[model samples]
Target: MAAAIKLASDRGVSAIELVFARNLFSLPVVATWLTLAPGWRAVRTRRPLAHLSRAGLGLGSMTLNFIALAMLPLADATTIGFSAPLFATILSALVLREKVGRHRWLAVAIGLAGVAVAMRPGGASLPAAGLAIALAGALGTGAVNITLRQIGRTEGVAATVFWFTVISLAVSGLGLPFFAGSHDWQLWALLVLIGVSGGCVQICNTASLRLAPVAVVVPFDYLQLLWAMLFGWVLWATVPGPATLAGGGLIVASGLYTVWRERQLHRSHLPATPTEL
Candidate 1:
């Protein structure tokens, strides 16, 4: 997705247009699923406002992240986006009234510190807009998480996904007239790939969570940075600089700690075994 966005931007595609294309591509997939599986009833929702809010957040996050992708190196943009977990933790506490233990709070602080380390403030190479957009996108991601938590209580997963894609497509498509850019066959193909890949990734991610314990599969998500780095080097010959490397390391560590703490908390809540007694 990052590669496609960057390439599209390079080829003069507007951020709005790029996201519009992606959502447009994704819409049919969801529609096809609805047609073949659960049908229209699957999209029925009692929480229209909540779904709308989540879709808004999703749009903001995707758009800002795409813009950041255009401005920053692929790895840096991708790593910064990982801060979403940190932001989501805070949102969970504030919005969901979920208790955040001291350990988790400390992990949040450490995770933010990792972001700061990655930014390398006072350095000549800082791209302020890119970083800010990425950070804001992460925060938007947190909002999306909070909204999803509420929506998930009453809404089916298919409903949430369908509404999100619809809202994203409508909002972005509205701006397409002013922002859309010219694309030859190759660029057009990239845009299509962007949508298809985005949908596939989302499906795979959802499937992973459903099929296994989240704690078991989530850690593998951090491997995205490794993939981003590899993609960066291979596609653009862009090696992660020191700040990116250091920052990415801290972000990954902090995220892992957060996950570990969640798993520990989950374990603590389980029925005590007779052996322990």
Candidate 2:
């Protein structure tokens, strides 16, 4: 999805246009699922406000990411975006009031350091604007993660995915008139890939949060950095700079530690045997 965004933006699609195209094309895919698997009634929701907030946050994250992809190296943009997990860890402690042990705190700190390293502040090598935007996108992603968990408690996974996409589609539709453009066949193909991939990802993301604790689930984002790096090379003939590699390494390690620590903590709290239960 990130790659397609880069490809489209390179072809002169503005970030807003990409957002609208994503939701516009993806809406049908989501609607198909809601119709066939769960029936249309699955989308019934009483929480318009929560959905609205989600739509806003989701759009913010997607827009920032799309812009970052245009301005930065693909690998660099992706690694920074993957910083969402670190942001999620911090948010869980402060906003959710979850007990954030020193281990997780340390992990979050290291992960942030990774972001700084990858960004390489005070360097002329990369665009500072893109770095800042990518980080903000990551922050937006973290906020979305927390919001999804809250909504998932009361809403079914299908409803949560359906409403966010629907709301985002509507919101982006309103903005489309301002950014409208005629695309050639190539750009249209990229937009289609963006929409389909984005739709599949939305379902996977909502289901993952509904099925697991947020911390445990979000840390898997680290794996994306690897794919991003590979795609970065294939699509653009670009290899990550030393700073990006160093920073990406830290981000990956921090994510792994966060996930491992969560699992360990969960194991410690579980009863050892049926007799204990």
User: Best candidate per TM-score, number?
Assistant: 2
Output the number of the lDDT-best candidate. Answer: 2
- Candidate 1 residue runs with Cα over 4 Å from true position: 203-221, 272-277
Residue-level lDDT tens digits of model 2 in 1-277: 9899998898888999999889888888898888879888888888989988888999989899899999998999988887898888788777777687899888888988998889988874888888889999999999999888889888888888888888888888887888879988988999999999999899999999888877789888888888888999999999999989999999888888988888888888987988766
lDDT digits (tens) for residues 145-184 of candidate 1: 6666677667777788888888888888898889886778
The per-residue C-alpha lDDT of model 2 at residue 68 equals 95
TM-score of 1: 0.90
Q: What is the lDDT of residue 269 in candidate 1?
A: 97
TM-scores for every predicted model: 0.90, 0.95
CA lDDT of every candidate: 0.79, 0.87
Deviation from native of the Cα of residue 128 in model 1, angstroms: 1.2
Candidate 1 lowest-lDDT run of ten: 209-218
